[model samples]
Target chain A: MKRFFLSDLLAGLLFSLLGFYILFEIAYFPVDEGNIPGPRYWPRLIALGLILFGLWLAGSKIYSRRMTAIKPNLHHPHQRQVLTILVMTIFYILLWSLFGFFIPTVLFLLGTMFVLFPFQPKQKVRGSIRISIYSLLIALFVYGSFYLGLHVPLN
Target chain B: MDAILQAFVSLFQISNLLMLLAGVFLGMLIGALPGLTATMGVAIFTPLTFFAPPEQGLCLLLGIYTAAMFGGAISAILINTPGTPAAIATTLDGYPMAKKGEAGLALGLSALGSAGGGLFSVLVLALIAFPMARFALQFGPAEFFSLAVFGLSMMIAVSGGSIMKGLLLGLLGLFLATIGIDPIHGFNRFTFGIKELVGGVSFIPILVGLFGMSEVLNRILEGSLQDKVLRSKLGRVFPTKAEIKRVTPAFWLSSVIGVIVGVIPAAGGDIASLISWEQAKRFSKKKEEFGKGSMEGLVAAETANNAVIGGEMATMLTLGIPGDAVTAILIGSLMMWGLKPGPLLFQDHIDLVYQIIAILTVATLFSLVISLYRIQTLGKWILKLPDYILNPLVLLLCLVGSYAINNSLFDVWIMFGFGVLGFVFRKLKFPLGPIVLGLILGSMAEANLRRFLILADGNWFQFVFHPIALTLFVLSSLALLSSFKKAPSL
Candidate 1:
């Protein structure tokens, strides 16, 4: 299946199911006198509309067979980088919980920069050092504005 | 006239003026950065304004809102990646300009166009806000319902290649909106017994996940690192007198389209930019230059996006109805200041409203100055930071930002869950904006529909026959029909 069609079909089905679930619940939960359409009426109607829409999408996709071509070049390759970043994020969150705001932010900035931007073929060492310094300064400014200047309670 | 003069006096107060400048500068800085959007910038800074007087605080946020839209153009010009969703159209021409070594020209045009758009919309807001608010105050539940439906119809027009997908997402968003406490009855609907889910999903967390986290995940999967190239030294960044004359028509045209679209509840800068870009293309003298470094295309996109800031605010201040997500947050901020926004606000606090309008105008001028003087150096420095270092730090900020919203760890988890969901949806090529729109408008749509049905004794034809509702319904149907004609198979 073309990814777009499949995604749309799944989303439509999900909504339709949710709508049915809401409708089923409304049977037990009675609406009071002041309420006009009751709790269930609008949701159930919207749900019905969704199910029909979903079915139409699925049927059309099957009949047309005009799936979007997935381009291979669009996929990201740096899985390890992303995983590393996620791990660092977890560490920072924990550090914030334990040590407070300023410390963890500084550490994350330094640690991630070190791991990610090792010397490339065209990169100059001097330029890299300069960038590291500039990054540190920017990080400090960000921390100062949010934590100290704004006086946000970190702990 | 005296009220307007008093408003200008308040706006020109040294402190308020300083805050406006600072707000615009900060907005431009944050907006130009990838992964940081206008909504996030506003949300994060909202708490900071707690210390300031209400007008000053509002002025600051308003400045940030306007400048951020313009700031997005910086990244669109220098990098293929748009700093905000509003800049997506800008990249069609801007990136082309940068690639052809006209980065300065592209940035310059964007700044000029943005200022013009902002100024034009502010004028519109000044002229029409009072009358519009009075008109909106006449709206009953049925009318509100019709408006919401009309707004939802734009989604069909917005579905670039797939109306089915757009509808599906819109439905899904509506479903998600049902997860919280029932608006009228105070009964829980779809919380599934989770206390955290009772407040409904935080829009910010979901937005952060969909835009910020999804981008990170996509980058991870695409592992091809962005090539870092030094900005090419080029000709004068300022447009020549002739170049200005060439783009003047597009600027005015886009500004008008942007303000009109922005006035509609739920439609925002992204829609405005897209619509304006299409219109500009339709009317351009050099239509073939589009997507190939055409200055007119860049001007239209930038102008419309910035213009929306003023137009959106006009509705928010006048009618308590936000035109987009950023303005929705601003509504929350306004409520925090104990200012009840709506038609009565104009009657009760006309001076404050005028001051806000004045501040918006001044802030746009400040944004122009800051962008012209500092953007080149700032853009270069920002783009120089490696993604590895920057992405992790931003993730940490996201976690903290979500946690800080309500001081609940549950929000953190929600942010992560939405992030993962956003990544998966992005992989499936689903557009994220419509879903957010659906969530925002879903409750309003549901509540009003229910009320209207009850008022009409459960007659659905009432929606079809009422003049305002009928007009809105027809317009919405036409928007959907146009989309279908453009892409019939989907």
Candidate 2:
């Protein structure tokens, strides 16, 4: 079952599904006053393309998968890091919305730098301080340049 | 003629000149970093650039564009890794030359050759684009529609060997582009009752996501925090007259090839360099001297790759089509600043157009001098910077650029969504070029198509009679067919 659903095939099916959804939504648009084709026309054209291409991608891969004896590797070494970054990003955005720009931005910068810094098990104290100072400098630079120098109200 | 004079004066202004230098220095930094592409750099910086006066903003953008191309040569020469994709070929002979302790000479020649090629292509661009714009000024809705179609055809042609994936992404872009209110009609199409979306998915956020955030995420996934670099000490960096004479013919021919390929839409510097390298190998008197630190190989690759800049600007300014991914972001920035990049720009802001040309010329000189002066010291410092710090800074910048554009939190979320999409597309080998190209041109193509339909009065076939329209259609078809037979262009 896993082999039956490849990435390309999944992308293809999703695209086709989105195309169909949009095709159905085109009906909700108010009617065109002119006798000519309306807002629905372009969407219809693209919907057709999506369906055709999606089918092509899936069918081609399905045929090839049967011929080849290959299994896709789904695991990656940096999966935890990637997920952590994504969580941190969402939290930054949430923090920005709750508080004004400065605190959230500074915290986000520090957090990101800390996450990215490769921590050694033995030499923790020295590395932590270096990254902390570096993150503050970067945050200050960004704040000064964008807000003070250029009058782009960060908040 | 007066417009040209004014353009020269405008470019010589102290502020404009300062911006040019700043852009070049920043571009050099970005290009010297591995995993930070010129396209992504330009895209990330575009929103911030918009805050400047239009002319100065444009100068800054042009500086970044040209210098980045030259900057790629730095990493390619010092380390085995290319700073940018355009410098991939430069690494072949470049690293070898460095191994023999001629890193300075190699750097000097690359900078000199790149400047020469850039200027040569600019000359051709000046000759060709204005006339082409004048010719296109006579076009009707049908003709413009055909031209837009022709541009879309470039999506598959440069899909990196996969037409299906390119077409899929292109179609996706076209569909997403339809999210705003219909051009001809007043009704909203895909807003889903959201007021923010009524104006459509903002171009800045999308660009930030696809190019900027996606890069940061990918680097995070790779988890290589430290820099893997060489400690090559560059010596005496000016090219001898004899060395210049030796590389001149190949340099000249490669420049020509670069412009042709660049003008073809989607065929970028990487493709031009590869093709020019092959042609140089065939044309060289010393065929056996190829690839083992051949001066001709380095010259051809660097010259042709940089030459693509001028050719790209020509297409982007004359037509609305992008010459490459970087120009696609430029188009987005142009639109953000309320300047449409088409034939109308030539008529309305002729001086501004010429100013871009002048800036390109000046940026070349500036980049050449800077590269020759500081290749050894600056290259060492840049190569030492670790990825962990750089990637986070870029991610922060991308966030600021997105949020600051409209002061909208929604746009940031939009950027996040597209970043995921871009990552998936990259992993699946889908070309990002078509997506950006399609998004930018989608409205233009759709509006023109509808206009043509209305003009023909229900007779779709009759509108194809215009010679330009017919010709464009034919050319697009031929391009599509050729793409099927050939390797990926861009």
Give TM per candidate.
0.83, 0.95
* Residue-level lDDT tens digits of model 1 in B261-378: 8887667787888899989999998999999999999999999998887788787777566677677667657755777777778888777788888888888888898788877786
Q: For model 1, what is the C-alpha lDDT against the true structure? A: 0.75
Error of 1 at B471 (Å): 1.6
Runs off by more than 4 Å, candidate 2 = A1-5, A31-35, A66-77, B223-227, B487-490
lDDT of 2 by residue, B282-336 (tens): 9999878677788899999999999998888899999878888899999888888
Name the regions of candidate 1 deviating beyond 4 angstroms: A1-9, A31-35, A64-76, A83-115, A118-148, B12-19, B34-36, B43-57, B79-82, B88-102, B193-200, B216-230, B264-298, B315-322, B332-352
What residue pairs are clashing in model 2?
none
RMSD of each: 4.3, 2.6
DockQ of 1: 0.40
